[model samples]
Target: MSEEVIQYTVAPAPPEPPRVPVRYAGFWIRFWAYVTDLIIVGAINGIILLPFIPNGGREFTIGFWTLTGVISTIVLYLYFLLMTKFSSQTLGKMIFGIKVIRKDGNLPSWSDLVFREIVGRFLHRVLVVTNLLYIVVGFAERKKGIHDMIADTRVIHTNK
Candidate 1:
């Protein structure tokens, strides 16, 4: 009869520790990423346009260069938009260990990626002074650039 009385006690699982605060990529890291991307784009541009130069970078007419500029701009925008859309990281971003994400901690959808890479980034370059969005990056709690803010995106370290 003594073996007939068995009691069961259940222990609750321990609470999960709070998640570590997310860290935003800093200005200099982002800057270097941009510079690296520029180098890549510049090299590609030079290769594609060199044949059109005809005299080793010294004999292009205004019309030729104007067309070249348009082509280069299109190429640049496509490069940024496609890369960001498919991978959320361009070559430079991959090398630099950063990525673009929506503010809600999710990957961006195609439209969002397009707006960010095109209207935000491409236009930012065309309108150079908008590059000063870095000022906001330096001051904002999330370190977001104007492009990032406009697209409701954030750049974060991936440690990859």
Candidate 2:
């Protein structure tokens, strides 16, 4: 029998660029961010009415509720406008080092913010079925709430 030898050459693997691991914030942090926002907005409204609180024992009236509704609307509008225009961060978000940005990582437009804040949020608040659906959809997504999807935005940790 003749002896035979075979040689095999292996190809070099292509070089890959190093990747920086992305860190996502947890649910608790996001929840706290919402709490902070609520507190800040509530405080603003409280401060606005602090001077008008009567010393007498007058029961709250329909006018009071109406005033409150108007103030709340204005505050919400201003909050959304400022966040969309100024790097997608409300005062609470800025404090928490979280910002809202488009899913593609771009600044959100005015229309997007308005739609998310007004229409999406209103629906979420009004329709119980829609609210449940929103929660389910948000959890089903990569942690993006319905409003975030409607606005094409995401909340990311700026400190990271």
Candidate 3:
């Protein structure tokens, strides 16, 4: 009897690039998430101001509008600051299963949160052109907005 020998060759597996975890939230989802947050915060502000608003004012004054704007800005800033520092989620983000974190997957410090949520975010909101530019960049540049670049942070889906 003659024995036959067979040789098999196996190809090496391709190496994977380092797994950088990115959340990759699309434009519409992010937009809706922000809208949800705005509604929640706006409702809170309205509740706080219900007593002060005149029942039948002829019209809103410039001063009243200005005051309301200032108060709303402060409330938004505080909301982001607290959520980013403590739990990495605003009420909407919490409900939507998203979170903010450092690019390196660490809990952001108070200063980081403040700088990111307050300074960067405020600037983005104030400059309409820049905000529009950021939306373009977010679609073009791996789902990161200008504020995220400035703060070296990212938004990711949270399991909880």
Candidate 4:
């Protein structure tokens, strides 16, 4: 009987690309970005609501207010969803030269944009205390907000 010997060889892992340092956006920068977005959205909402707003105070019923609120919300959501999904930046972000990217270093997908822009943002707005989540931008190495964390994303500078 002849005995056969088996040999095994392990290949070395591929060398990773040189690491480029990521420049994180700070709290102040992010705050301004948010403000810019608010102004843009508010302006659009104002224009849309203008026609519907009654001429005098008599029509300011609860139903009118509720309907206005819902319209504003839908417009805001659609704005964020479509803009972020396509460009990874809203007008505010574009102006600020910042953009959202997946934490894993991939470009954000539609679902990621949806979660970050709609779900996470809605929760952040509703929970007033969560507004403090912006503090994380000051301290976190990645300068990620609660919404960014929830959506596994990071806001990054485009110039760099």
Candidate 5:
């Protein structure tokens, strides 16, 4: 009895689509964006709260905390919080063509925004050492700052 040998043929695997490279915004660009944001915030506060400030936004009402200070803090927090929530970017970021994104590639949740914009940023500004933590973005592999690390976020350049 002669047995015929059968050969099995395997189909070639499909080719994967080319991956687009993600560009992380570096420290200087982020710094400039932050400066722009500060200017914008300053303008907003100047226009809206100038009359209410006791001593030209420098009066200390409670242990270095003035009415202007308090109001500015509130506005600052609200600006970051609302802008990131609605647009995933502030006006400064828009000008710079950068945006905040979650590392998991999902839409950022309310908790993420609060943690990043409010708690993390507050910590950075509240302490000198923490403020320096912003420098980490320059060294981090993905260009994440302390706030981005805390919130599992990253700032990336968006296609304009």
Candidate 6:
């Protein structure tokens, strides 16, 4: 006696949708965002330092650093660090509809934010000469500043 065998076939999976391309923010937009951020930071520092400035705090110096200068630096670092850590963008970036993202397409970690905001940005601001480093953002193909490159990050538009 001969036995009959049946074969079952599975259907093919559907194709995935096409991916949209990412758009990197250019220098001009980034510059405007930075300017807006500076205004906000200045407002914050002014409010916080008001009481202390009455005692010559603005001119007070600790070695080469003025009292207000030090405080301002700390405030700046905290603003960038905390903003990027929690939301991956500052108020300026959000207003401009741009955001910082890891080059590998992952969310940045605390260490990455710290490096980008504190260490890298500090280097740029530590001396008058180094501030020119920001100009590189305009020349870089990825529209990354030194700090962004240091942290392996990219600033991209959300179009929102």
Top candidate on lDDT is 5
Residue 82 lDDT (model 6): 92
Candidate 5 lDDT over residue span 1-160, tens digit each: 9999999999999997766677999999999999999999999999878788676544658776777778888999999999988999999999999999899655578999999999999999987888899899999989999899889998889983
Q: How does candidate 5 score on lDDT?
A: 0.89
In terms of TM-score, how similar is model 2 to the real structure?
Answer: 0.68
State the lDDT of candidate 3 residue by residue for 1-160, as single tens digits.
Answer: 9999999999999997677656655566567677888898899899876666666865345664655667777888887788778898788777777778887778887777877888888888877776775575356555767777778777777762
Model 2, 41-86: lDDT tens digits are 7888788866556678553557546555666667866765676577
Model 3 TM-score?
0.73
Model 6 regions more than 4 Å off: 1-18, 55-59
RMSD of every prediction? 6.8, 10.8, 10.9, 3.8, 6.4, 4.0
Alpha-carbon shift of residue 17 in model 5 (angstroms) = 9.2
How high is each candidate's TM-score?
A: 0.76, 0.68, 0.73, 0.80, 0.81, 0.84
Tens-place lDDT per residue, model 1, 13-109, is 9998766567798888988998899899998899887766555455544664576787678878888888888898989999999999998878898
| Candidate number achieving the greatest TM-score relative to the actual structure | 6
Candidates sorted on lDDT, descending: 5, 6, 4, 1, 3, 2
Give every collision pair in model 6: none
State the local distance difference test value for candidate 6.
Answer: 0.89
Off by over 4 Å in 4: 1-19, 57-65
Q: Tens-digit lDDT track for model 6 on 1-160? A: 9999999999889887666689999898999998999999999999988766856434778999878888988898899899988998999999999999898766799988888999899899879999999999999979999999889999999882
Per-residue alpha-carbon lDDT of model 4 for 32-83, expressed as tens digits? Answer: 9889998999999999988767776544446546667888889999988888
Whichever of 2 and 3 has more lDDT, that candidate is 3
Cα displacement (angstroms), candidate 3, residue 64, comes to 9.7
User: Model-by-model lDDT, in order?
Assistant: 0.82, 0.68, 0.75, 0.83, 0.89, 0.89
Ranking according to TM-score, highest score first: 6, 5, 4, 1, 3, 2
